[model samples]
Target: MLVSAAMLLTLGGCVTMSGDYNVTAVDANGQPIKMVMTSHGSAIYSSRNAFCSNFPKATVTIRDFHTGEELKSESPYHCR
Candidate 1:
């Protein structure tokens, strides 16, 4: 029983799970302007001056890289 407990503890360290999302902003030319990886939804943003200045009508997309699912998308944001 002691050996089993030790094995369980060792195995626990190998168990890893991540729920990270990839946020990307692209210009009208389909060029990636900015990208970020985060675990929280609130960390994503749609507006960026550097990206939007070059491509005023840029698109921002967020996807769950782990699950291969798109979480959100926005376009035609106002940029200064």
Candidate 2:
């Protein structure tokens, strides 16, 4: 089980995001369900929007790691 989990994580990748920000998926009730610490670089988080579809009332929030600036928030992703 441990090996399979490791293999899956290796192949699946982390959080489906990459950038210098805190990316989080918030559920309808204003609870963070998924979050990832991205590497420092240009931002590209297109897949984060999918959480809205999957969770229906979910929101995807991207914030600057250093300054705490909110960089993004789309249609279905309204954060608390």
Candidate 3:
């Protein structure tokens, strides 16, 4: 039981809890234009405005930190 408990604790510590998401903006040629870190979808808009001002036509994609899943995608000009 003690060994099981110790293993559980060790495994729990290894689990990552980071919720930060990566917001990447790429140009029409699929070249990276900008990158931002945010925790949620709503935050992406503000981050987009800040990081992607010079690349207004860029395609923006939000990805999960751990799973690398594409959570959202939109154009910088279309973001609110």
Candidate 4:
């Protein structure tokens, strides 16, 4: 049973996307909020002016390591 559980845990970890990268959203007050996103592969580390509120929105960009192009991005909502 222990071995099975361990195997399940390992498999779960493998199925999960890379969580090493993250994006943050700031509100009008400049408060930080965490975002959940799968890596889409982009070179941009950050994007601004994404928010439509009084404050600007920021996104953490990722790129495919091999192609050096956009992979994915995480945009945390602000004033929502």
Q: Compare the candidates by TM-score and give the number of the best one.
A: 3
Per-residue lDDT of 1-80 in model 3, one digit per residue for the tens? 99999999999766333455777777766687645666564665676676557665567777786788876434334322
Clashes of 4: 11
Q: Model 3: C-alpha RMSD to truth?
A: 11.3
lDDT of model 3 at position 20: 58
**Leading candidate by lDDT:** 3
- List runs of model 4 lying over 4 Å from the truth: 15-24, 31-80
- Please, what is the whole-model Cα lDDT of each candidate in the order they appear? 0.56, 0.59, 0.63, 0.41
Query: CA RMSD for every model?
Result: 12.4, 10.9, 11.3, 9.6
Per residue, candidate 1 scores C-alpha lDDT tens digits across 24-67 of 57777677775543545444442234455556776666677688
Report how far off residue 79 is in candidate 1 (Å): 6.8
Tens-digit per-residue lDDT, 21-70, candidate 2 = 66567788878785564534434344454555566666776677787777
Please report how far candidate 1 places residue 29 from its true position, in Å. Answer: 1.5
Task: Name the better of 3 and 4 by TM-score.
Answer: 3
Candidate structures ordered by TM-score, highest first: 3, 2, 1, 4
True-structure lDDT of candidate 4: 0.41
Per-candidate TM-score against the hidden true structure: 0.44, 0.47, 0.51, 0.25
| Candidate 1 Cα lDDT to native | 0.56
Candidate 1's clash total is 0
